[model samples]
Every structure is written in C-alpha cells, then in structure tokens.
Target: MTDDRVLPRAVLWDMDGTLLDTEPLWGRAMEEFARGIGAEMTPELRNATMGNSSVDALTKVYEAARVPESGRDFEADEDAMVARVLELFATDLRWRPGALSALDLVAGAEIPMVLVTNTVREVTDVMLETLGRDRFVATVCGDEVAAGKPEPHIYRRAAELVGFCASECLAFEDSPVGAAATHAAGVPAIVIPSAIPVPPKPTYTYRETLEGLTLDDLAAVFAAR
Candidate 1:
C-alpha cells in the first residue's frame, strides 16, 4: 500500500473482538456449546474459531471436537452459542480499548461509519444498541451476506450501505478473517489484534490499538495505499 493520496469515503468497523471485548464472551458461549456437543474448548480450537462466522466456527469446532456434522446439530448448536452470547451481552458487554473514543472521534468528524461483522444480527444488533442505536448509519452482519468474512460479501455490502464502494472505504478489523474480508473487498484495512494473535501480514497494515488513532492516520494509510 504505497501513498495513493486518496481519502476514504466511509469507515467500517468490526464488532466482536474489535470494537467490543466480546471474544471472551464468545469463549464462554463456545465452551457451553462444546460441552453440549460432548466436546471441549481447547485453546487451539478457540483460536481457530475466533473470528469465524457461526456456521464456519461450528463446522470447525465440530470437526475438531470429533462431533458428527450430521442432522440439524450445527444449527442447534449455533442457536445455543448465540443464546449464550446474548445472555452475556445483556449484562457483561465489555468495550475494547479505545474503541468508543475512536468511534466518537470519527463520529464527531461526521464521516459516515458502519459496523461490519461476521457476527449474526441477533448479537450484533444488541451490541449496536449499546454502542448507541444511531451511532452507525448501517451495519452489515454475517446473516445478511451469502458468505461471511474470509469472503467479501459483508464488507462489500457495508461499503454500499455507506454509499461508497469498498475501494473507497477504510475498514478496521481485529481478526485475520475479518481483515481478509476487508482486503478482499478492496478496502484497505487497519487491523488491531485482539482475542487471537494475528500473524503479521503484508497485505494489510496493523495498528497497536485504537488509542490515539486519528482521521489523519487513516488518510496517511490511504495515501500510502
């Protein structure tokens, strides 16, 4: 990403493990789901499924847990996980470091922003309500797309919702799967590692945290792109 000297038309945000410290919440849910399926939540398995969509995560966990991927088990377990997270969200929703401040900075600037997440709407909507129902102009969730992160549909839709193409947007992501989706959407992404460790990737640039992030910082990255 060399200095392209261009400005993004919109900004996109990832929810779980990004704007919110919800990975642990997801972990709790995952553990419950695992136990229900006669599996265990090993660290490796947790890491593997961290940023994935419900189906993808379920499939991976199920495979790793050696659970037969048969019948409606996937959907049933997904609902269980969702239920667990919803219950957690109601009382323990935590914010990621500098998340709200960064959001306020962008919102104050009047740049339209959107929450783009692989999380299903059942959870994302509740998080948005806490973030402030009107904080984002739009939110594109996993359930809205034909495919989730690691696939570009959600990001593409988010960019569209904000009246811009993905190439004209700046996306913030905390997970490699989400980052990959942003990158695939032709959106230059700023990744802030959370819940799961992100291996350094040359395709997308990373920030240490949302703390001290400025619109100028975003433009600098855009310029370099």
Candidate 2:
C-alpha cells in the first residue's frame, strides 16, 4: 500500500534522556562530582541541570551546594565532571526503549536526521560509538554552538546544517529545556518525557515512547505545523 502521509524534510533529535539513556550516568557523575566539591546534588538542581550544557550544569551544582564563586575552579570542575561521566558511558551507555527501531524506521524511509544535543562533543562522540555516527547527516554539540538547549542556537544550527529551515524539520525531545529550544526555533517536536516532566503545549505532539512510531506519526506532527 502506498503511504499517504507526508514526511518532514529532516528529523532533529536530542541526545541524553531522549535517545540514549545517559541521563542516569550523567546524574551519577554529577552527584559524585558535587560530593567531591563538598556539595550534595539536590533533586531540584538535578532537574534544572537536565538538558543543560556542562558549564550550566556545573554552575547549578555549585549554587545548590552553596560553593562560593571565589572558591570555584570552573574549568577544572568541568573537566573532572566530564571525565567521570565518560568513564560511566564507556561501560553503561544504552538506548532508550525502541530507540534503535525508531532510528532504523526513519533511516529506511531515507529521511535525513541531525543530532542536536547539549552534550559536549567529547562526551557526545563517545556516545556516538553506540548511536552509530553514520546515522546522522550532522551532529551539533553544545561546545560547537554559542549556547545549548533552551537557547535555540543548537536547534537552529542543526536545521541549517541539514539544509532545512527549522519550520521544515520535526524535532524529538525528552526534556523541557530541549522542548523550549525547539519551540523557540519554530520546530515542531514529538516530545517523549524521560527524566523530567515537560508541560503540554499545542505546538508539541506528545508520545509515551518511541515504540511503534511510524512515518505517519511523524508526518502528522510535521503536517500540523
């Protein structure tokens, strides 16, 4: 049977909790890093850090821990945090449920994809080993852009790199920060909440999971825009 639904020009994806179940690993590392700095990682701070760049995440940790700015060594703290997260990633990285199948489904349809994440390139590259570098036409990392998620820069750059206008693309996100970025960029997204709950918005299409998603599901989101 011929497919009647129209597909998007390109698909934009979020990393971390959205595609890879790396949020837990990042959290573990953050918690440990916070402890080392004499700070406890609070739930509120952890949620705030979700979908944020390493710099932003670390800053939040410091504030929550009540570490004075005069005592903070941002570069060193960031490096250590990233290093610890990488160690966990090397042994524990895994895909979210049905993420692999969803990826294959999109690839089989020949829809170009761009990975847009607040993850730094160093850590993102390591995760890419499991995600397969060949799947995406372009990968935009936090370090590569002036700002990360919740800022719209990363999403805007990804769409541009993929040769599509933000309006022509459909984004898949799992966090409020990520959703905000996509919305600000004028990209309609299919939001599947992961580590944190994202508020409902008319501009976003919600799904419980990536399982059983079809081109029609994606097309419906794009067509609505």
Candidate 3:
C-alpha cells in the first residue's frame, strides 16, 4: 500500500525498547528492586505499568508488593539499578533488529533525527553514547520536561528544539504513552511494538520494527494518502 502522509522534515525516535534492547534489562532491575523490598513482583503488575515513567513504575512496584512508600529510599535503589543497567549495556547493548539500517536510511536522507524518550537524562545519555548516536539533533528526556509520556510537552519540546512544527515531524515510538504524547502534540506517530503491546486500531499505525526500511521505504510509507 502506498502511504501518502506528508513526508516529515524530521523524525523523533524513542529510545529504550525502540532503539535498544533495554526493556528486559529494566524488567530485571524492577524485579530486583521488588525483591530487595520484600515485595512480590507479578507479571500482571509489570504489564499494567509498562511504559510508565521510572517514578510511576517504582511507585507501582511498591504498591503492588505491598511495600510502604514512606522511608523506602527509592533513590538509592534506583541509583544502584542504573549502575547495573549501565554495566549490562557496556556488554549486552545492541540496536534492536533493523535499528541501524533504519537510522542509516534516515541519516542518508538528511532528515534530522531527534531522540525523544521518557527516560531520565542520565540514562538516556548513556544509551545514546553506547549506541554511538549521540549526534542526534536534540534529545528530550522525561525528567527534563515538566510532564513525561502521555503528555504532549516532551514531544512539543523536542519539535521546538529541532525547529520543526509538530505537524511537520514524525514520531517513532514503541509504547502507548509515547504514541499518545506524539499524537497529542499533533505529530504523526508510528508505533513499533517492543515490550509493550500495541493497542488496537483507531489509534496509531503499527510497524514490526524499522527493519527492511530505507529512506525510500519511509518516503513511500509517508507519501501515501
């Protein structure tokens, strides 16, 4: 099928599951956190809170494990987990399937790519540095914005930093919250499911991943009505 949406001047890419295979690492960290707090971490609970901000995710972990939030010293745990995650990335970090190819395609097209993610600035920097994509035109981290995913502020800020109107940018996301935020910002969003399941239609366009896509591939997808 020919996709005829207007071609975007820039593309906003999600980090974490979209570009790197970090969601499982995050899950492991969360599991460790829950165990450290003597809380029960259930798959259902994880599913419910997948794609949430770190703060929200931690809060859910605490609530689900029946742990007391007060005096729980989440910061220390989070710090330790981040350290471990960094270590894991140092060895295990790799681009998701077809990520490099897709990025190359975009780069070859001379389209400015911005990393827009709900990750904290520090972690986001680490991922970008590790992936060697630190040269992105701009990066908008959830912590840098007043509100995170599911709120359009981050997406709007990213577009602004790239000097593009929301309508002129295309957002690539792997989470419902990210897609919602992009949509709310008036940008066209493409969903690539990772750890989180994609919602049914009437919301966003779903792609397997960026695999098998070239600049021409994207152009064709975006040029369709």
lDDT for 80 in candidate 2 is: 84
139-190 in candidate 3: lDDT tens per residue? Answer: 8888888888888999899899989898788878887777778778887777
TM-score for predicted model 2 compared with the true structure: 0.96
Writing each residue's lDDT as its tens digit, candidate 1 over 19-92 gives: 88888888888887877777788898888888899999988877866866464486767777888789988889
Higher lDDT: candidate 1 or 2?
Answer: 2
Top candidate by lDDT: 2
What Cα-based lDDT does every candidate model obtain? 0.83, 0.89, 0.78
In model 1, residue pairs whose N, Cα or C atoms come closer than 3 Å (at least 3 residues apart or on different chains), thus clashing, are: 2-224, 3-223, 3-224, 4-223
Model 1, residue 151: displacement in angstroms? 0.5
**Model 3 bad stretches (over 4 Å):** 1-5, 201-203, 220-225
TM-score of each: 0.92, 0.96, 0.89
Error of 2 at 31 (Å): 0.7
lDDT of 1: 0.83
Ranking of candidates on TM-score, top first: 2, 1, 3
Question: Candidate 2 residues 133-182, lDDT tens each?
Answer: 99999999998988888898999999999888898899999999999999
